[model samples]
Target: MLDGIPPLLTALASGADASIPDLAREVPEEEWPRLLEIVRRHGLTPLLGEAVLPHGDTCPPTVQDALRTHRDYAMLWHRIQMNDLALILEALGGASIPHLLMKGTALGFMVYRHPWLRLVGDTDLLVPADRVEEAHELALGLGFKVTEEWADAHHLPALQRESNPPIELHHQSLYVPTPEPGYTLVPVDFSLLDAEAGTVDAGGFEARVPSARDALLQLSCNFGSHMEESIARPLRWVRDYAELLGRGRVRWSEVEERIDFIAPDLRTTVLMSLALARPFIGDSYEPALLEAIDGLPNPYARLTRVVSPRDMVHEWTTSPRRAWHVLSCLMGPWRATKWSLNKLLVSREHITRQTGLSGDALCMRVYPIAFALHAIYHLRRADRSRGE
Candidate 1:
């Protein structure tokens, strides 16, 4: 599975004619559409258009034109995003709320060659934990409505308004729970990050982004968490890490010291991210940094080394492999086993919610039968769809 990067992806990412004369030429004519779909799904269409549009006559006119159209749409989408960001930042500023931009939106401004080149799904803003509720209310006052919520989530339920991107109002850095007892990946201290954060000129406005070190930590942890959530694209995340490293803002020595002092458990998450991105990054990063990452003990060495980034993408797209990948992400076999058990023992309220059946004494008695019938129905429906 660790064979190598996919050729089409290499062509798209590196834009090297030596890799392929035409990106479309790398795949069969019939497969070109599927390839384009993969790129779009993986959040590479903006870059794809930019890469292939310049090499006229190399790719099919239809391919080039389609990519160019998507590229133009991405640019237009970016304008909408920027408008929303400005409005959100203005609201926060007017209220005197200390807010720092996080994730893709911030990286777009601070690291990417062009803000639109980095595809963003939503705007992530981190406010002080105490002010998060106030900010959430502010978002509501500004017309955004809550779309999703989870009790233990790091961010408040996601908020969105019509004609604008969703907003994840975070109170703290996200954390990943490891198999190690009572130990989760180290989370960034919002206060420390806030103090060290620097402002970027976001088109007539000043918005704060996390310090380089904190930003790297956040990306690494996010990679781990999103993998478990089945919403991550290896190519997208690896590109993020590679781009960030290319900026040369990080101090490896200081990052190492911070990891060691604050939480060594975070080392694996950071190492895994860099290690995966290393192949794509080529000689951009320090050899010493690679050496240090290699020297550190990696419990997932076999799993990480054996699975290529392309394999990661496949694991998400293909079944059985998808199940296996999710199991691996449980951190350990014992944890995975425990999780399976806990899932089977879900509470009565969960059953009530799922079946919309009353939780009365009679319903409680019949709940097992009802749940089994529901499961059977779901499995049959899935099988029918698959067969179709």
Candidate 2:
């Protein structure tokens, strides 16, 4: 099943432009049946063929099978979102955290026709930075253990819950690395919280969400930071921005002012989002959106292309290199080196705590091989540069 279906599903997931014939040619003939079953289960077959398959006179049998089995997976993804949101709000209320729902769920409840139509995996909640520790305690009290214990042990405040439907607690608006030295597009300023809580009924569950302006800023900063697949969680932010614009919830000028003041570097991401969702958002924002695009730096301006191929792969994979990259991005070069060394030391300490190994013994057993590999890679690169 994996041999046949994994590659095909991967292609579809990555928005690849392979045709039915093209896919059939690549897939192993013996595994085609199992591959088709997996594709049907995911409900991606029809969307893949109709939206992605190239025009051709000859179509593969798998194409027809996939089309027949295709259901809207987006809707299913949405139902999961609704269930998760319900759980998140319940957890927050139980914990006594005065939370504001941030991105996808908030947008869906406020603007979209059906909340399930917008695909979201987890629910995001915002609390004051000062209240972050309180929020974590609240989540723990409600049975949601932080998923990344290593991160928590390292002093990163973000925590994930162990609930069937997980909730992520954010005290800081943007993710900052301990080793990385850089300012975010959105500075960690809890002063921006001017809370105006209102309730929305989702299938009889009441949800309390953030104010319109703050919600927009949170979503904008999140999208800006992770520009690669901002579009993956679709329609929520578009609906929010459009509805806010339509209702005069906040003036266009005020939105622009907040964008400049809070997440100035996100101008590129916001404009790109407006452009992608223009079909849903409409033409009125085109001029201002283009102007925002023009204001972005050249690197950011080309963000769409910059986050291609390997970028998407890295995001989905759990390779150590990706972990290292995340560490590097959070902490700049010098700090990353120091952090890695400290992490190695701490890891040894933890190992010693669990086992009876002394610190020097653990370091001798572990550090030499790792350090040797680093030395070999650097020396080889230097030799290549000198025509070795």
Candidate 3:
């Protein structure tokens, strides 16, 4: 279980009535840096400002300055993102393309008290799968260039405008490629989200956001998949869920039903996400939802003593390897075998793109060389771990 969670974070998540002044007074000046790092790591810098800036005098001058800087930077970026979004929305609307905002961009408007309080690192806009290429064309027409690699199965390559955040035109909400060619383990049902979507006004234009039920499920799927895949823990997701649930906006029954109907395989993932956010939600969670979570099959039950934010933070921070190892075990041997086979038999186009090399002979030779290098990488990591 995670231990030594800074009290500052707990107070921050403790709702509107939390005594930020008392918490700030109790915090040692020396501890500010560590707390700030934790907050920053979780994408909570702007949120920290919201909670602490009102009681700024209680904090150290340096910490106050840092918080202000983070808040100002986030606010500025947020405005740029909104302006860029407005233009993109206009372009898409003109083309008669249907789009729904997803992830942080959507959650900021739907859940947060103030949109800027939710820091959007990038904009995620979902378009119908069939229309994604057309949407991609529209994005390019708007002078946004593909600043990255070729489009993946889930979305077009991230498009960026000079001096602004990147935009991802998504055909799928989430995609987890499996070792099997032409198969993805997790592909969100766009129709469900699209059908139940609601519109929110972004200054001058209207943008679609997933309904509360869909929002919670999408967040759960994203959060659960990340943890299971050993992706970095971002506390902002917990905050988003906390805000939605704390305000009594979510319909737990609908969310649970949707999960069961569309993706029963993700039941555990959804539970893990909810379990992690449950403490932060205080008394807001529905009793039936808690009961359902308790009743769900928990494969990771043995791995974690407590499924709370503190423990999650501890697990990720103190020993990322342990978290990875547990997730690897949960992923099972079949997935590992499939992944290895997939790597060995990578597409010719991918090989050419990656190595700038062509021909069957050269690509065949790359197979052995790639395997050796991969083996060496893992071997070195194992040796380092043993030595430590």
Question: In model 1, which regions exceed 4 Å deviation?
Answer: 1-5, 11-31, 179-187, 261-263, 296-298, 317-320, 329-334, 337-349, 352-388
Off by over 4 Å in 3: 14-17, 174-191, 228-231, 298-300, 303-308, 315-320, 332-388
Error of 2 at 118 (Å): 1.8
* Predicted candidate 1 versus true structure: per-residue lDDT over 1-388, tens digit per residue: 1345457675444333344545455556676777776776567777766666666765667788888887787777778777877887888988999998998778778777677777877778999888999988988888888864432357888777774567788887756546432225355566777887999988778999987777887888887655533335567776677666755667667677767765677777787667766666646678778886676464555555656666655555333335334545545544443332222234446756676764354254543454344334434423322201
Clashes of each: 0, 5, 1
Give lDDT per model, in order: 0.65, 0.48, 0.68
Candidate 2 segments whose C-alpha is farther than 4 A from its true place: 1-96, 150-163, 174-191, 196-198, 211-213, 228-254, 261-284, 302-388
The pairs that clash in candidate 1 are none
Which 10 residues in a row give candidate 3 its minimum summed lDDT? 379-388
What is the descending TM-score order?
A: 3, 1, 2
Task: Please identify which of the two predictions, 1 or 2, would achieve the higher TM-score against the true structure.
Answer: 1
CA shift at 191, candidate 2, in angstroms? 6.4
Highest lDDT: give the candidate number: 3
Worst 10 residues of 2 by lDDT: 379-388
81 Cα displacement, candidate 1 (Å):
2.1
